[model samples]
Target: MDDDRERLTSKPETSDPLPKAEHPWVETLKTIGLSVVLALGVRSFVADSRYIPSGSMLPTLQINDRLIIDKLSYRFSDPVRGDIVVFHPPAQLERELVANGEKKFQEAFIKRVIGMPGDRVEVKGGKVYINGKVLAENYLGEPPRYQWSSTELTPDGIVPPSHYLVLGDNRNNSYDSHYWGFVPQDKVIGKAILRFWPINRAGGITPQPDYNN
Candidate 1:
């Protein structure tokens, strides 16, 4: 009778270790599920992870400054004047032009929109004149006077009926519309919505107030 009771108590101890071996697979599945969730989150929001690559938008956006470009907002409406945009260079035009018909690779540029379709654009006394009126820009770090050529656009050069003209805030140092031309509506990727990374500079990028509309 004493031996029979001891045998029954030892049976439970052997069974308990079997379930511990099964837990590894359950933990692996949990880790995989979390990874999928993170990937989906990045795709949905404007990723708060981009860096400025050039000095074209210097006074406002600096090189190496990480930014958050909004990919959703522009889906509801077209880009407006004074909006800073990122886009691929217009096809066929290059950083350098050929003497006859040569092609060169011009990296994409970033700049602010000063004119749009159906609007006349001009620059005088370092001031931008749109539709026979002067535009007030309080964001420029310096007046644009001696750096750019006096540009005039005819009805045909006026943004191709669906395009936009853009320029850098640092006019003298930027190579923008004064060189290549207008940005095609389809080439526009997204708007620069905010500055991130540098905790001190993290904030929303307010859209330039619209006086033309």
Candidate 2:
């Protein structure tokens, strides 16, 4: 009777063991890693944030204004006129920077598209002319203080294929297409869709100008 009771009470032995509880530190590290990966993925392929550091886009985008750049839309379609774009400096600008002793010159720029492929662009008498018609830009706080001839950037003033002419709303202050050259389609990072900083000014970026009218 005693032997039978002991055999029934004894625990069974097996090769398999119960899983050990994960260490709290290990769990924390895993969570952090996953968060970082997700953030990077979203920033690289989905959307990202940028802050304006200059007045190039002033009256439209103020200095230090935070913007959400849409990285996915241009994947399905080409950029159009009036889109506020952020892009890496073009080769021409990069070369100029290097010649001027700028060793690290991979800065990005933000500007509004003013001319598309094969479009004629010119700036004279404080007004921008596209295809010989004056561009009705009501967003400018003031008229451009400089002049840019059509042939200055390219022969015949036509924007080359896969290239875009971009300018700042603060045209005279911006070092842009008129100074360096056109931005290649591939250099564009994305378009600025919304401004989310400075509560009072927070809203979608300036509406796209109507070119058809």
Global fold similarity of model 2 (TM-score): 0.88
Report clash pairs, candidate 2.
none
For all candidates, what are the clash counts? 1, 0
Task: Write candidate 2's Cα lDDT for 107-141 as tens digits.
Answer: 78999999899989878888888888888888888
RMSD, model 1, all Cα superposed?
Answer: 6.8
RMSD of each: 6.8, 4.1
| Residue 197 displacement (Å), model 1 | 2.4
Quote the lDDT for 146 in model 1.
56
Which residue runs does candidate 2 get wrong by more than 4 Å? 1-18, 211-213
Give all TM-scores, in the order shown.
0.71, 0.88
Error of 2 at 57 (Å): 0.7
